[model samples]
Target: MIGAYTIGKKAVTFGYKRYGIPGAVASGGAALAGYLIVRRALKRSTNADATGVESAIDAGEVKSAVEERGLGAVTESETLERAIDEEDVGSALDMNDVQSAAESETDAMTEGSEGDSSDER
Candidate 1:
């Protein structure tokens, strides 16, 4: 157990010497070269090798759909809309017809209730 502890401590010290502390203060160029060589040997965690900058933007890791930053006053901005669709127009007409039917039914029920109360009197 004592031997194992000593070996572990030595291994951590070795790692810190090689990479943990940025380039040695004694030599500039050689130290930087050593650091670069060691880094090249290690695996990179970025997708830079597989995708280009355009792909990165298209992937949209940074979202853009948030409400715009503005003052407290509410203001409306005209947004670009798609050309009017036939299906949308048809659905709107159908919705208006259904609304009219519902209103007429409600009015008839109200009149019927009033007539019943007068008859009871």
Candidate 2:
């Protein structure tokens, strides 16, 4: 009876040892896959945000430069005529919208400059 009990105990231990290796391997593999997926998603989101921010900064710089150089500074009527001639009738932007956007950008730039000057004092 003692010998039989010892054999049963060894068999259970052997079974557990045999299954444990594969279980541990599967867990590690799953963890690695999850990490890779999250890492890739994070990288893509970061790249997209960076691209959007860069485009915004570049647009602001161009607008500021144009304002400083007084380039294409046309009256509203002239701007309307030019837009009508150059763009299709179905174009989304009208003369008034363009003029208002330009005015707002200039205002913002001037405000920023004034703040900087004040800081210097």
Candidate 3:
């Protein structure tokens, strides 16, 4: 009976050891596949960033050239036309006037409230 039990245990151990090899291979394959995918994605992102920086430098150079040539030197249909568009300084001053008027009215209301409370006392 003892000998039979020992043989049964050995058979089970051998079965597990055989299957373990395939399990290890599958794990290693998955890890390697993930590494390759991530490496490819990083390379593509780096290339896109380099291209964007180059384009920005070109845009800055064009703007600088327009400024140096004076507004009259710029042709009528160029991008410089949009850059030199007039801003309404008068309307900005009107906004400040409106804001000050609002603040003065609020101060008056607070003073009126205090005067009424004093009269009641």
Better of 1 and 2 by TM-score: 2
Candidate 3 C-alpha lDDT tens digits along 1-121:
1122332343334434656755334333322222222222222323334323222222222233333452222222243223221121111222233223333443454477689999999
> Over all chains combined, what TM-score does candidate 2 have?
0.32
Question: Candidate 1: where are CA atoms >4 Å away?
Answer: 1-93
Assess the local accuracy of residue 53 in candidate 3 as a C-alpha lDDT between 0 and 100. 22
| The candidate that achieves the highest TM-score relative to the unseen native structure | 2
**Where is model 2 more than 4 Å wrong at Cα?**
1-90
RMSD per prediction, one decimal?
Answer: 30.8, 28.5, 33.5
User: Tens digit of lDDT per residue, candidate 1, span 5-65?
Assistant: 3333443454467666432222222222222221121112122222221221211101111
| Model 1, TM vs. native | 0.24
lDDT of each: 0.26, 0.35, 0.32
Q: Could you tell me every candidate's TM-score relative to the true structure?
A: 0.24, 0.32, 0.24
Model 2, residue 92: C-alpha shift (Å): 1.6
Residue pairs clashing in model 1 are: none
Question: Cα lDDT for residue 95, model 3?
Answer: 27
